[model samples]
Target chain A: MKRIRTAVQIIFTIFTNGYAYGFLRGKIYQGNLKYACVPGLNCYSCPGAVGSCPLGALQALLNRRGFQVPFAMLGFFFLFGSLFGRFICGWLCPFGLVQDLLHKIPLSRKRKRLPFHHILKYGKYVVLICLVGAGSLFLFGGFAKVPAFCKYLCPSGTLFGALPLLASNEALRDQAGGLFSWKLGILIVLLILSVKVYRPFCQYLCPLGAIYGWFNRFSLVQVHWEKERCISCGACQRACPVDLAPEEISRSAECIRCGKCAAACPEGCLHFSKKPGPNPDTKPDLKPEKRT
Target chain B: MNVMNQWNQKGGSRQHGSRGWLFGLLVGAAFLCIGGIRGELAVIWQKAVMICMECIGIG
Candidate 1:
């Protein structure tokens, strides 16, 4: 299942960024497909990107001259969030794949949670509300509006959009200045942290993840936990990359639906299901067996 | 008690059944149609086709 997921991630990444000619010529694809927004945190400026990024589209809509509600982008978010929630983060995001691969490297002992993980996870929400929401809507320079998150924070843009563009376009490289350096520095730190942590960016910084996470409890696709099944072995908790407990597996906003917990379950209790079962947060009457 | 036990004891789960998702899908579709009618998709196309300098952290 993990292999299949990895294959899907790779294939989707390639499909989203499939315009070989754009990469070769150091130009972005100016196609009709750009009208549609992709579900993940892919960069719109990526040379080969076939679709606009949802976050970028939202920011652009908010930053427009006339202040209007971003109904289209909100619709896109609602539609995607209802369907899969953060399953898109787990299986579709190119940056997630990069972080997954980086964590596999034997650079240091892999940690499940970062320091102050509980408090720090809320950072993504702060970023979403402040940078993507308020910064785009309020901050302006005379006639120009700034997409604050894209300009300052989005490591996906730095990695997939800027680096690829710079590598192929000498003009773009020559134009690189202090701003580019700052973004690059952020990208470097994130990439390095990926080796020691499981998706630090997704856990702490991604606005898209913050948005999709809200729908995890109500999404069509979901992880179902069967309370009747015997044995509350800690395997599922141990296997969970993000440190989510068995009870939290079904409804937790942080769950990316990677299926590692389900796979790790010794009893055939935990499973992914489209059909709704018992409420995820319902506690079992059976007590957990004391481990010697 | 372990962290899981502590969390389970706290028990503040909000329940939204299958109807919730169905309603969400309908709302999303309706909003999408309205936005399309307003030519918001064309705005997205126009913005996306051009190289976003800010996206690349350049300008």
Candidate 2:
């Protein structure tokens, strides 16, 4: 499943950003299909990118008056989030693909699990609320300039959108300044961290991930834990790359729905379900039976 | 940890029945219709095609 997912990610990445020769000429695709959202964190400025990024669109629109709502972009997000949730992160995002590939690099430590990882999961939400949501709307919107998140943070933008342009355009390289260096530093740090920590950007900084994760409870495709079938074997927990125990598999907001846990389950107790289930609650015992 | 262990040990109904699917479809349709009316496609096109100097922090 993981191998297939990775293949799909690569294919989607190429299909969306396939103007490979454009990089040499330093030209971004200026076609009509560019209006469509690719449902992932692909950069619009990528030479081969045929679709716009939802985050970038949202930010871009913020700086323009009478475009406050960003209805089309929000609609795309609403549809995709409702259908797949963070499955896009696991299965389609180019940057997510990059992180997974980076983490696969042979290292002294096979996997480095961060302590208080659950607490860190909220970081992405904070970014969504403050940087992407507020900063773009309030600060940059008033200034009628570039969005704050894209300018200051967004390693994916730096890596896919900027780095390629810089490599190809000599004038762009000569014009590189302090902000470029700062973004490069961020990109370097994220790239190195991706090797040690599984999807550090998705877990800690991606506003897109945070937005999609909220819909996980309602997404049509979801992980359903069959308590009756589970034998309490530790295989699923052991197999989880992000270190989520079997019980935590369905509910963990940070779960990318990568299917590692489902694959590891010996009894096939874990599976995807289209039926509506109680969104997994972090506090299982205290969760009120809201349905009943 | 103990609560998680206990919760995992217990058996219960796995999935629920909700109107989320219906609601989701309605919301998606509404957004798409409004987006079409608003000329959001043109906005998306302009943004996507333009070289965002700010995206690279060049500004």
Candidate 3:
């Protein structure tokens, strides 16, 4: 599953940003194909990115020449969020893929689960609503030249877009100043955190994940629970890379739908349910069938 | 928990589940409709064609 997921990630990364030679030319792709938006987060400034980043597009809408509300971009967000939920984060996002790979590096301390991790899950939603949603309209609406998130915080812009541009273009180095250093600092911190934590950015910062997570309750694709299956041995929780409980599989907004928990269940109690189950109870251990 | 249950009671899990796809379709259709009218595709195209130097922090 990991192999397949990695392959899918690679394919998506390539398909979205395939213009590899653009770095050498120090030119971004200026083709008509740029109009479309991909489901996952990829920087619009990425020389190879064929599609626009939704966050950037949303921010772009705020300062657009004619002050349009960007219904089309919002529509894309609604459509993707409602359909697949965080499945895009699990399987498609290049940034997610990078974090997953970074996490594989050998750590002797055995990955300390942050104490307030679950509580921090709500942070992404705040970022989505405040930074991505409102900040664009308020700050950028005032004719602030740059989108708030991209200019201030997005590490993907720094890693995939800015760094590559800086490396290839000699003239760009002289232009680097306080903001570049600040963004680079953020990118470095996130890179180190990715090594120590499982998708730290996805858990606490990604606005895209926050949007998709809200749709998880309603998404057609979700992890199903089989109440009648065997013992509730804590294997699934132990196996979960993101450390999600088996019961919280699809119910919690934190679930990435990575299928690690389903694979680790010894009793085969968990499976991806296309249709929603009738169970009202959210807790796995308290289920009536398990009691019986 | 009472408030939560009341919220849950308003929509059964099955109905809630189905609403997911229904809402998705409706929103997707709405986006396409508005996009067509606003010529949002052109907006996206124009943004894409222009190098966002500010995004890269060069400007």
Higher-ranked by DockQ: 1 or 2: 1
lDDT of 2 by residue, A1-292 (tens): 8888889999989898898777878879888888787889988988878888889887876656644687766777778887888889999999999999999998747554566776877888888888787777777433475577888888877888888998898887788899988998999998898898888898888999988876665677777777655666677778777777655666555678899888888779788777543434432333323342
Cα error, candidate 1, residue A62 (Å): 0.2
- Candidate 1 vs candidate 2: the lDDT winner is 1
Query: Which numbered prediction scores highest in TM-score against the true structure?
Result: 1
lDDT of 3 by residue, A203-288 (tens): 89999888888788778888877766736777878878777766567666788888887788877878777775444554555433
Which of the CAPRI classes, incorrect, acceptable, medium or high, describes model 3?
medium
DockQ of each: 0.48, 0.38, 0.59
The candidates, ranked best first by lDDT, are: 1, 3, 2
lDDT for position A171 in model 1: 93
In candidate 3, which residue ranges exceed 4 Å CA deviation?
Answer: A65-68, A140-145, A277-280, A286-292, B1-5, B9-13
* Model 1 segments more than 4 A misplaced: A285-292, B1-15
What does the lDDT read for residue B52 in candidate 3?
Answer: 70
State every prediction's TM-score relative to the real structure.
0.93, 0.88, 0.91
Fnat values, candidates in order? 0.64, 0.57, 0.57
